[model samples]
Target: MTFKYDVIVVGAGHAGCEAACAAANLGSKTLLITMDMNKIAQMSCNPAIGGIAKGQIVREIDALGGNTGIVTDKTAIQFRMLNRSKGPAMWSPRAQSDREKFIHTWREIIENTDNLYLWQDSVKELVIKNNTVTGVLTNMDVQFSAKSVVITSGTFMNGLIHIGKTQLRGGRISEPASYGITEQLSELGITVGRMKTGTPVRIDGRSVHFELMAEQLGENDFHKFSYLDFEPRKLKQQSCWATYTNEEVHRILRQGLPDSPLFNGQIKSIGPRYCPSIETKIVTFPDKTEHQLFLEPEGETTREFYLNGFSSSLPLEIQLNALQKIPAFKDIQIYRPGYAIEYDYFDPTQLLHNLETKKIKNLFFAGQVNGTTGYEEAAGQGIIAGINAHINCHGGNPFILARNEAYIGVLIDDLVTKGVDEPYRMFTSRAEYRILLRQDDADMRLTEKSYNLGLASTQRHSLLIEKKEHINHLIEFAKNYSVKPQYINSGLEQLGTSPLKQGIKLIDLILRPQLSISKIAELIPALHKEIDKIKNRKDEIIEATEIRIKYEGYIDREKMIADKISRLENIRIKGKFDYNSIKQLSTEARQKLDKIDPETIAQAARIPGISPSDINILLVLSGR
Candidate 1:
């Protein structure tokens, strides 16, 4: 009655895709089970990927040999480097993808990958024996056996959709709700809660009044997501529009408040804090007269556009009435009304740093099912879970990433340590060593580690080695070369900086905030000649060398601090500790410790109610 696999990955969304790819790529016989094969890797909401800290996670996934960055680059219609004016640590690469093509690209890669298989079915229950998961039971009464299982159910578990006063059982707009698994998991004593997220309505692109909106064009220069040297196919780029909702639009939305699931108490789940619904925005930002809305094309060939900031669960007519008041959408014809979905999510604190369940051996969870809220976040967890599942199946050490190592590390640590009361989204401020975890350096950070783990490919490692050599050579060249005083004064004077009175090393000149390697090339004939040699990789080499020179002090300082705190992380707190029996710990610490079972002393220190005194007591007790 059972078929076999080394790993069984449930759900074929971003998280599931990466997990299956990672496991399969690592030589595990993996089976990817999904509700609909046609919907694999579908962008359930916006048709874009990466932003701010989110972009760093995607690149980290790519560095670790995951398919997201490769798929994104291949299907990208528009690419932009966000926060370029800021420091290199803040610069993130974002791409507007052809949603249809993104999925197709992911599916093709998976199909061609070694040791991976696809099954179309809903997983209803886990085949459990003792305290570990042996496999999953599908809706068709088919049992598939695996040594380890990873569930990346996303928002499809026990999903409920809300449209004003009308409600329906659905995962997405037209997709049916998935059931049985949540109830079954709860029966196994997993702590579960409801989390809500919503999407904006789609409009016929031809119906939009484009003349009234601000045209946000793509940058002329493109930066790709993958560290691989392959060139992605160039697609004709489309422009996105920016518009705002005024007081009039707010008034119209307010009128529909009574019917809103967000306001009418129809949905009690906590929605994403950063990406609030339009209805919530109206009430939360009452004094603000307007809110920005981005109109993004859903696909390269499709005429439908997603109204980015206008997510609402009000009645269909209410959404239409409100849209009609906006200047650009006065005659907007909606393809669908925005709706809120409430789905079951497990508290991520129940998971280990490797994403395996603490309660169930050989079982892991990722993505929205773990209360995270972005595609990049999900993909990051997916690859980690997949790697650990495969390692566990083969009786190897678990793979883990620490906070200072990568953005993916920060995400997993935050979720498992602090847990989420509301849907968690990544922000640059959340990372303490952001200076060390720059998106530009993701390959240098994780590719070797992934390669050692058998997750990253040899070609990825070779490319990384070549890139680092170029960067090092350029850095050494800049440090040794001297710039003539007269060579940079003209450029310096224009930037309002004092002209150089004496010759200085090129690295020193490049370190000045007002001067850049590329800018100085316009003045110094020698520098220009040297830059031309970098050729196709000139911009990338310059960026890497500049950041290393400018941020050397900050990066080293963070590394020292990270090294100190890493000692605390190294001191593990036993999960089986009977916190209740520890009288020296405070009442609140005892309760929190017992509940979270913090994996390390550093993680224990981060809990809300736990204090320095509590950590001191734990250190004394654990003999650290």
Candidate 2:
């Protein structure tokens, strides 16, 4: 069979879904090819979405018109805003989703989208011609032609799953490993490296003694994932049980360590240091007597509960023995054993800012294939790649977000500039301007860009405009209006905060760490009415307003710093620039610069060990 499309997207996981939606939604005739239609958007590891910096990326993805946030909101059984006790910059929204519903909702959205077609088959090889990807060849010997192609194959390229001494050639539990693509890419001179990630065992919830474990419930007031208004599900929320690993659990895990792929020198790939295996934790933190394990529900109706902190690749008998050592899991029935899978990924530095392969035009890569770890990170990259792939085919400039703009920007910039020695995970520390890139204002910052790119709907664009005007009006109103001691002092005292001695602008009062906009609105009826007009916008808008008032000085200072760095970003390096010609440049700097072929002075500066002297030489050579 022979099919043609403007963009061909391989794999329908979180990344592929976003990639396909981005391209098709932007008017490309896109084809999404997956090995199994039923497994599209499957949460292979955890049932939850968004956390820490990852949550911020999801909001940004939603603001850009991607489906992740909407899907998460539609399927979430419980919701919570993480880091509420911290600064506004740390406030992130998270959701515990029904695993099955999450996947189903993604499929429903993708299937309903016009100009997006689906194919059920494994992509075998890229049909490259003269260093440009023309299409893809599938396992069935079918050819799907396209002007551009995006590969978002998450942990499926030559995957091998290890369970102690037993190993299998597969991706997830039963999903077959994708073949041929790795060999074909190798033939094209792309270097591939292996990396491993593991998931915890699933136990039958009915068999576990939950009473022995501490019940962890969702917050009283929860926030939805999507910025858009949707009816919040009022279904009875499920509770996760918390237990701990005793010395006995460690003893059982130790027995399997000698035969473990991670310790036995059988696995060559590096694992995520942040999320280590049970054996790894035991060995590394030997002084600590125990580790916490969360027993979370996989779904409302399913009997399976995920063993959150017990991720391991130990043999089945050893895994069973270890679980029995936990307080509540004495009678637990194993639904599936946990295992680690190692797969191939390309060094993201090999790709350009647009996520297009430097070795092959019209070919883009995203997700774990680009050495990123989480679902949100992969989806963010996928959306950008999909948008850029569509634009590339139409001969338009690619949309590139700077580091100051978003967490997505930080992710892509780090990948393309610094690259990754291990799987890349997003954290607030990774972004220097994180305070300015808070989750609450993602739509305000990026919706206009999405609208300009034709991805956001006109209604969304108008809504964003209205939101901006309203916020501006509120800011001005707060700045102009002063609160007298008589009107505000009583409420301030009631809340246990220091009473106001003199009249001050409402904005200045709100800038206090203890006082919130809502609290002030409760005190003044006029200010209350103004807040009531936009109360439906949720904590996100209020938080944005609050941060604007409290951190305005810091935000301004950061923007000035960003402006200085952005000058170097604007100084583009000619593609043909010769690093070898700079005799004064350090040998190490010259070798690194020549190898990476950085696109701008900003990117070159970010590369490790590229000194100020090397930058001066490059700037002089480039006539900047």
Report, for all candidates in order, the number of backbone clashes: 0, 0
Model-by-model lDDT, in order? 0.89, 0.88
Q: Give the range where candidate 1 is weakest over 10 consecutive residues by summed lDDT.
A: 532-541
Tens-place lDDT digits, model 2, residues 1-624: 678899999999999999999999999999999999999999999898999999999999999999999998887777788898987788888878889988888999999999999999998889999999999998889999999999999999999999988889997878899988888888898878889999999898888988898998886453666778546565557887788999888888898889888999888899988889998999999888899998888887888888888899988999999888886888879888999999999988889988998888999999999998989999999999999999988878889988999999999989988888888999999999988798888998899999988998887788788778778888999999988998778889997799988999888888887888888888999898887787556555666677788888988998999999999998988475778877899999988898789988998999987999999988888887
**Alpha-carbon TM-score of each model against the true structure:** 0.97, 0.98
- Candidate 1 yields a Cα-based lDDT of 0.89
lDDT by residue for model 1 (48-147), tens: 8999999999999999999899888888877788998888889988889999888888889989999999999998889889989999999999999999
In candidate 2, stretches whose alpha carbon ends up further than 4 angstroms from where it belongs are 220-222
Q: Give residue 308's error in model 2 in angstroms.
A: 1.2
Cα deviation in Å at residue 563, candidate 2? 1.1
In candidate 1, list every pair of residues with a backbone clash.
none
Worst 10 residues of 2 by lDDT: 535-544
Backbone steric clashes in candidate 2, count: 0
